[model samples]
Target: MSTELVSLDASKLAELIRTREVSPVEVVQAHLERIDAVDRRINAIVTVADDAIEAAKAAEAAVMAGRELGPLHGVPFTAKDAIDTAGVMTQRGSPIFKGRVPDTDATTVVRMKKAGGILLAKTNHPEFSFWIETDNLLSGRTLNPWNPDRTPGGSSGGESAAIAAGMSPIGLATDVAISIRGPAALTGVVGLKATHGRIPMTGIWPRVPRRFWHVGPIARSVRDVALAYSLLAGPDGADGFSTAPLQLDAGVGSSPGRPLRVGWLVDAFAPVDADVAATVRASAEALTSLGIAAEPVRIPVLEEINALELLWKLQVMETKPAFRKVTAGHEDKIFKHVQGVYDTPDTSIADFVDAEQKAEQLRDGFAAYFQRYDALICPVTTVPAHEHDAAEFDIDGQKVSSLHVMTATAPLSVTGLPGLSLRFGTSREGLPIGVQLVSPWMAESTILHLASLLEAVSPVRGLHPDMSRI
Candidate 1:
């Protein structure tokens, strides 16, 4: 019964709770028990909220009293460790902030609680949430649920692994490059990087290069992500970038009045695995069967955009100085990856200015492409979940730079566009393969609508890891 309850998506769980078919305490206990049973293998959860059961008891009382409930009433969810949670440990996967707990919840955490979602636990991440894999001195590492030897992808890998393993139904995650989407792709879940700043970044760490950072949801379904986005978006009076409102009532359905047009690209990023490319092509073909016009298109600007260079510049020029100031006296405690940021050559003001100008041009180029297509479909990464321990790997028998993992994602990050990653198929080794859906700046609804259409035809839907093996 606990396994069945944990397998249900957040929307279904909320429905059962609202109908009195299940109690809030039952839901919370089921997830907590699942975490205890499975988390030792993956190490995804860094801190389990001690007051979760008490909160669940209060929620049960509210339900028994027949009080009005929020959309996610009694549903349990987790947040990445980098996001502030009042009275809950948020170590940021770095020893420097060990045992740290915030006095107040992040704006997103407050909104999630307001919507009646119980905070069950905090998940792992790379130190300072700075790397693409979930490993740090603080919490060790978060392994892929599909294959214990492989990574779940990071910096939101722990949240992805937890959701994939059915320890949580939905979660809060942040993405500067591919933190949210990459991990979701590797773990066979739904990750939405809403239009940058659609969700507030008020309580997240490393507030530098604010333009590329995004707060979003990771769930098991498109509808669940859409629901969380509606609850978590909008200006919080603190994050200036979140001032613009989202079109909550826009066109978001599997069947629209007019057939949608989608552009598909497999080699947008170099050296894509043949299996990964095939899966993306299969997704595009599947969309055509749903009466959507799926065609091939290319944006040469994708080649022109240098994602790693921009990220390095942001790290050296903006994030490093600010982060160093905060961890001044405890330099030795910082993660080696983060400490390396300080050793990087300082970026000149002129170079930083030029990079910003190039980023604007890239955004404009994508905007112009969107004028011709309703949405763009591409691979989330070059390959499926790879084994940990190496910085570089081979793709299609060719040795490539390790940064290829974020190549396809970083361009969209720089543009501040909305990007969604959904499970479409699996690799030859049975690992999940995801395709990315990207739309113009504020057109998140378009991507969600298309994702819903694709989900209905996805071969990987309803397939989950066998947690008993863990």
Candidate 2:
């Protein structure tokens, strides 16, 4: 029964709870027990919230009283540690802030609670969310549930691992580059990097590249991702970028009232694995069965501006300084990957200004592409999850850097557009391979609608790792 309870997505769980077939307390307890049973093998969730049951009990009372319920009413959600939770430890997977706790919930967290979602726990992340993998001096390391020898991807890895392991149904994750989407792809789940600033980052850390930081949902199902996004995207008045008075509509089952065109590209930003490339192509062809125009696409600015390198250069200036300020005296407590941040060469004033200009060109390039196609499909990573701490990978006889994991994703971050990660294929090694669906800025509805359609045709839909092996 506990196994079945945890396997249910937030959407189905809420439906059951709302109908009184299940209670909020049962949902919360099932997750807590799942955590105790599975987290030891993966080290995904680092801090479990003590007040989770109390909050669930309150939600039950409201439901029994015949009061109004939100879409996610009585559901439980976990969050990446970088997101602040009032009174819950938000150490950011670093020993530098060993016992740090926040005084208020992040705008997203508060919104989730208002929607009747209970805060379940805090998941692991890389030190300050700066590295390519999720591990820290504080929480040890997080292993991929699909293959224990592989990584679950970094930054938002633990959030993905927890959901994939059936510990939590849906959770909050932020992306600076590929944090949210990359991890979700590696774990065979769904992740969304909403239009930059669509969701506020009021109580999150490492806001160095403020324009690149995006907060959204990671869930096991596409509908759960849509439900979370609908309940959370809005201006909270505290974040400067989130001040846009935009009303979001998730067009899941319905397409725009006109013909839809999509373009798929796999070899854009890096040398991708053959399997990964094939997945992107297959996803595009699947969209055609729905009467949409799907074809091969190439946006030149991707290689010319080189968003992956540009993002690294910009971060060397912004993220490095902020990291140094916090790790000043506790440098010894930091992980080697984070310590390497300081070793990065500083970006010169001229190059920094040039990267900023190139960012505009990248955005202009995508704007032109969208003029012809409603959405774009591409590989989320060059390959599936790599072996943990493995240095590099061989892609079609060429040696590729591990940094290529974020190459396909950093482009959207540069353009401040929306990207969704959903599993559409599996690797020869039986790991999940995901195709990214991207849309122009604030066109989240189009991407969601397309992802919903693709989800119906996904070859690996509803597949998960064998938890008994873990």
Candidate 3:
């Protein structure tokens, strides 16, 4: 019964609650019970909300009173620990901020609750949301629900695992480079990182490098993400970046009047795993099969910029100061992953300026690429979910540093473009593989429209990780 309750996407759950077919309390309790039963295997949820059942009760009372409901009314959702939740312990996966509780929700969290989505729990992450795998001094580590030996991906790893393991139908997650997309791909779920400014970042921590940070929804289905995006987007006047004047149309169960031109690039991040490469190709082929004009294409700046390095260089210049301030007199609280950042040499003035210039050019390059195609399909990571704390990755033939995992997704992060990650294939070991759908900044609808169509034809659409072993 708990499994069935937790399986419905947030959109369906909201509809069920709205019609009185299911009580919000039943929905919330089922998730809570599921987490209690399975979170032991994943370590994904660190703090279960003490008042989740009470919130569900309040939602039920409103329904009984015939109150008008918000879009997500009565749906339970989890938030990455890095995002603020009023009166909830948002320790940020660190002992430095142990017991820290925010006085208000982040803008995205505020919107989630405003839509009647009850806060269910806070998931784990790397300390300060910095690592490639979700292990920290505070909450330990999060494991992939598909296999215990494999990682769930980082920063937003716990959030992804919880949703994949059926502990939550959907969640709120943040991404600077690949937090949302990578983790979702590593697990088997759908995650959207909207155009940088489309969703406000107010009330989220580690605000340095603010322009690259995006808050969006991670769910089990495309329509649920679209529903969450509609509720979460728009300016709250608190964040300068959140000034997008237009709203996303979603365009679900619909298509554009013209044939949607599509492009796919796999070799740009050469040495990509054969499985990952095929998944990207399959995505493009799926689009072509639908009568969309699809073909191989490249954005020159991806090769020129080496975005994985550029993102680190650009972010280090801004992140170090914030780190110093937070860990001042508390250096003992720091973790190795974060300590590595402090050990890396600071960018020179010339190098920093050069990176900033390259970033603008990267954006221009993607703008030009989008002019030829409405959406681009690419690999979200070089390989499927790997084992935990590996020193390096073996991509195809060549062994590369762990950072290579971000090579495919970092370009979009640097450009502030909207991207979505959804499962389209499975690896030899049965791990889920995802493809990324990207579009020009603020035109999330185009990417999402393409995503919904791809989802319809996805070979692995309804496949879930076999969690029974764990």
TM-score of each: 0.97, 0.98, 0.98
Model 2 segments more than 4 A misplaced: 248-256
Query: What is residue 209's positional error in candidate 3, in angstroms?
Result: 1.1
Cα lDDT over the full model 1 = 0.89
| 1-470: candidate 1 lDDT, tens digit per residue | 79899999999999999999999999999999999999999999999999999999999999999999999999999999999999999888888889999999999999999999999999999988888889999899999999988899989999999999999999999999899999999999999998888899999887887878898999999999999998998999999999777655243344546667789997768789888889889999998887787999998778787866776676578787788887899977787768767778898998888888888888888978987888899989888999885578798689977778888898888888889999998988989999999987777888998898899888988999976665
Q: Quantify all predictions' global Cα lDDT against the true fold.
A: 0.89, 0.89, 0.90
Best candidate, lDDT-wise? 3
List, residue by residue over 46-144, the lDDT tens digit for candidate 2: 899999999999999999999999888989999999999999999988888889999999999999989889999999999888777898899989999
Clashing residue pairs in candidate 1 (N, C-alpha, C atoms within 3 angstroms): none
Model 3 residue 43 CA deviation (Å) reads: 0.3
- Please give the distance, in angstroms, between residue 448's alpha carbon in candidate 3 and its true position after superposition: 0.9
Q: Model 3 segments beyond 4 Å from truth?
A: 248-256
Q: Residue by residue across 177-291, what tens digits does model 3's lDDT show? A: 9999999999989999998888899999889889788889999999999989888999999999888755443322245476777889998898899999999988888888887
Q: Output the worst ten-in-a-row residue range by lDDT, candidate 2.
A: 247-256
Task: Let me know the TM-score candidate 2 reaches against the reference structure.
Answer: 0.98
